[model samples]
Target chain A: MNAVKAIFLKELRVEFRNKQMINSYLILSLMIIASFRFAFSIIDFSITELASPILWISFFFGGMFSLSPIYKREIEQGTKEGLLLTPISPSSIYFGKLFANLFIIFCLELFILLLFFVFFPVNIPDLFSLLCIIVISTIGITALGNLISAISSNLSQSEVMLPVLLVPVLLFTVIMSSVSVTSNVFAGANIFDVLDEVRLILAFDVVFIAVGYLLIDYILEE
Target chain B: MLKNKLRILVSILAIIFILISVYFALIYTPPHEIMGDVQRIFYFHVASAWISYLAFGVTFFAGVMYLKSKDFKWDNIAFSSAEIGILFCTLGIITGSLWARPIWGVFWRWEDIKLFITFVLWLIFIAYLALRANAKSRTSKANLSAVFGIIGLICIPFSFGANRIWQQYHPTILVSSEGSLQPSMALSLIISVIAFTFLYIYILLVRVDIEKMKEEIDKLKQKVGG
Candidate 1:
C-alpha cells in the first residue's frame, strides 16, 4: 500500500512538476472536441444524441496522450532501472501507474464532458449514471492503456505505435460498451437498461487490470 | 531427408483434396433453393473463416507457450500461424463480401456482429504483425508479440459478444440452431477445411524453416564481423 501510494504520488508529483503532458492532453482533447462540433451540425443531427461518441472520442485521445508517457519517461531517464531495483513488487508499480493514469484520464474525461455540455447542446439526463459510466469506462481504458503503453514504451517508435496497438483492442472492449451505455444514459434510459454495458465494462476493467498486473513482470523483463 | 519427403507428401495430399473439394462444391452439391448457385461460395467462405479462427487460436496458444518456455521455436510457430491466419481471414472476408454483394445487395453489412468482430480481429492481428516488424531484438519481438497476441485473443470474445450487449444482425445460418447442413454440403465443407488445414501446416513448415535459415545467416554474419 505504501509503495503504491508512493509511486502514485511520485507520478502525480512528476506530472504536476512539469505539466507538459497535461497541457498537451488539454490542447489535444479541446481540438478533438472543437472539431467534432463542426463535423456534426445541430441542424442535421441532435447534439444530445451524438454527445456520447463525441465525449468518448475526446476521452480516448486524451487517455492515449496520458498513457504514452507512463513508461517512456522512465526508460528515457534511466529511472526504469531505479524503479525495478526498488524492493517493491511489479504489481505495485503497475497499479500505481494505473491509478495515476486513471486519475489523470478521469479528470480529462470530466473536463471533456463539461466542454460537451457547454459547447454542444447536450444534456446529462442522469448525471449519476453518466458519471458512473465515465468512471467505469475510464478504468477499463486506463487499465488496457497502461499495459499497451508499457509494451509500446519499449519500442523505438513509441508515439506512432501506441495508438496503432491500442485502438483495435479498445474498439471492442472499452469503446463499444462505454459509447453504447453513455448513449443510453444520454437518451434518458433507466439504469437497468444500460446494465449489460456497464457489466461488460466492469468485466473488462477487472480482466485487464489483472492481466496488466500479472503481465507487468514479463513486460518489464530486461 | 525424411522431413522433406513428408512435406512433399503433405503438399501433394493438400493439392489433391483441394481439387476434390472444388469438384464436390461445384458439381456434386445441389444449388440453394432460393439463392441458387452463388451459395456455393458458402463452402469456401465458411471453411476459410473456420481455418482463420483455428489459425489464430494456434497463434495465441503458441504465443503463450513461447512466453512460458522462452523458446524461439514457439515464436516462429506463432508468427507463421498469424501470417497464415491473416491470409485466410482476408480470403474469408473477400468471399463473404462477394456473396453479400449478390444476395444482400451490399458488399458489407455494418450492423452484423460477426462482420464487425471479424474486422476488428483482423486489425488486431495486423497490429500484432506491425509490432513484430518494428521490434529491434529477438527477445523484444517475442515478448511483445506474445503479450499482444494474448491481448488480441482476449478481445475476440468481447468483440463477438458485443451483439449481446446491444441489438445486432446475427445472420448465422451456415451453422443454424439445429445442425441442419445437408450431408453433401457438409462433406464438401469438411474436405475444404482439411485441405486448408494441411495447406496451413505445409506453409508453416516452410516459413519456420526459412526463419531458421535467416537466423543462421544472421549468426554467421555476426561471427564474421566479430
Candidate 2:
C-alpha cells in the first residue's frame, strides 16, 4: 500500500511540475470546442443533436493527447530504469500510472464538460445519470490508453505509434460511450437505456486493467 | 530442397483448385433470385474475408511463438503473415464494398458490423506495420509488434459485438435469427472457402520464403561488416 501510494504521488508530482500535459489537453479541447461552436453558428441545424458527437470527439482527441506523454516522458528522462529499480511491484507501477493519467484526464474532462455546457445547450433532466455515463466511459478510455501508452513508449515513434495503436482497440468504447451519452442528452432515456453501455465500459476497464498489470513487467524489462 | 519442392507442389495445386472453384462459382452455381449476378461476388468476398481471418489467426499464433521463444524468425513470420493478411483483407473489403454497392446501394456503410470490423482490422495491422517500420532495434520492434498483434486480435470479438450491442444496421452473418442459407448458396460458399484456404496457405508460404531470404541478406551484411 505504501509502495502504491508512493508511486502514485511520484507520478502526480511529475505531472504537476511539468504542466505541459495539462496545458496541451486544455488548449486542444478549448480549440475543439471553439471550432465546434463556430461551425454550429454557420449551420442552421440544432446544436443539441450535434453536441454528443462533438463532445466525444473533443474527449477522444484530448484523451489521446493527454496519454501520448504518459510513458514517453519517463523513457526520455531514463526514469523508467529508476522506477524499475524500486522495490515496488510492476502492478503497483501500472496502477499508479493508470490512476495518475485517469485523474488528470478526469479533471480535464470535467473542465471540458463545464465549458461544453456553457458554450452549448446540453440539458439533461438527470445530472446524476449523465455524470455516471461520463465517469464510466472515461474509465474505459483511460485504462486502454494507459496500457497502450506503456507499450508504445518502447517504440521509436511513440507519439505517433500511441494513437495508431490505441484508436482501433478503443473504437468500440468510443462508439458505445458516445451512443449512451447521446441517448441520455437527446432522448432523455432512462438509466436502463444506458445500462448496456455502462456494462460494456465496466468490462473493458476490468480486462484492460488486468492486461496492463500483467504486461507492464514484460514491457518495462530491457 | 525438399521444402522448396513441396511449396511448389502446394502452389500449383492451389492454383488448380482456385480455378475449379471459380468455374463452379461462375457457371455451375445458379445466381440468387434476389441479388442476381451480383450475388456471385459473395464467392470471392467471403473467401477473401475467410482467408484474411485465417492469416490473422496465424499472425496471432506466430506472435505467441515469438514471445515464447524470443526468436527473430517467428517475429519475421508473424510480420510477413500480418502483411499478407492485410493485403487479402483489403481485397476483401473492396470486393465486399463492390458487392454491397450494387445491392445495398452504398459502397460503404458504418452500419455493417462485418464491414466495419474488417476496416478496423485493416487499420490495426497497418498500424502494426507502421510501428515495425519506425522501430530503432530489430528485437524491440518485433517484441512490441508481437504484443500488439496479439492484443489487436483480442479486440476483434469486441468489435464484432459492437453492432449487436449498439443496434447497428450491419447484417448478422452467422447464427442469424433468420433461417440458414439456401442450400445452393451455402454449397458455393463452402467451395470458395476451401479454395481460398489453400490460396492463403500458398501465399503465406511464399511470404515466409521472402522473409527468410531477407533475413539471410541481413545476416550476410552483418557478417561482412563485423
- On DockQ, the leading prediction is 1
Clashing pairs in 2: none
lDDT of 2 by residue, A1-222 (tens): 787788779888988887776687788888888888888887687665666677777788777888887788888988888988978888887788888888988888888888898889866667777677777778878877887888888887678888788878886645555554465556566566766656766776777777777666666667
How many residue-pair clashes does candidate 1 contain?
Answer: 0
Segments of candidate 1 deviating more than 4 angstroms: B168-180
lDDT of 1: 0.85
Q: Where does the lowest 10-residue lDDT sum fall in candidate 2 chain A? A: A173-182
Question: What would the per-residue lDDT of candidate 1 be over residues B57-132, giving only the tens digit for each residue?
Answer: 9999999999899999999999988998899999999999998887877899756777787788789989999999
Candidate 2 per-residue C-alpha lDDT over B4-112 given as tens digits, one digit per residue, 9 for 90 to 100: 8988888887888788888878888787777778878888999999888888888899988988898888987898789889988999998998987877677887766
Screening candidate 1 with a backbone cut-off below 3 angstroms (N, C-alpha, C), the clashing residue pairs are none
Please report how far candidate 2 places residue B31 from its true position, in Å. Answer: 2.7
What lDDT tens digits, residue by residue, belong to model 1 across residues A95-150?
Answer: 99999988888788878877777778666678888888888878888898899999
lDDT of each: 0.85, 0.78
Model 2's DockQ score: 0.50
Candidate 2 off by > 4 Å: B168-184
Q: Where is the poorest 10-residue window by lDDT in model 1 chain A?
A: A40-49
Task: State the DockQ of every prediction.
Answer: 0.61, 0.50
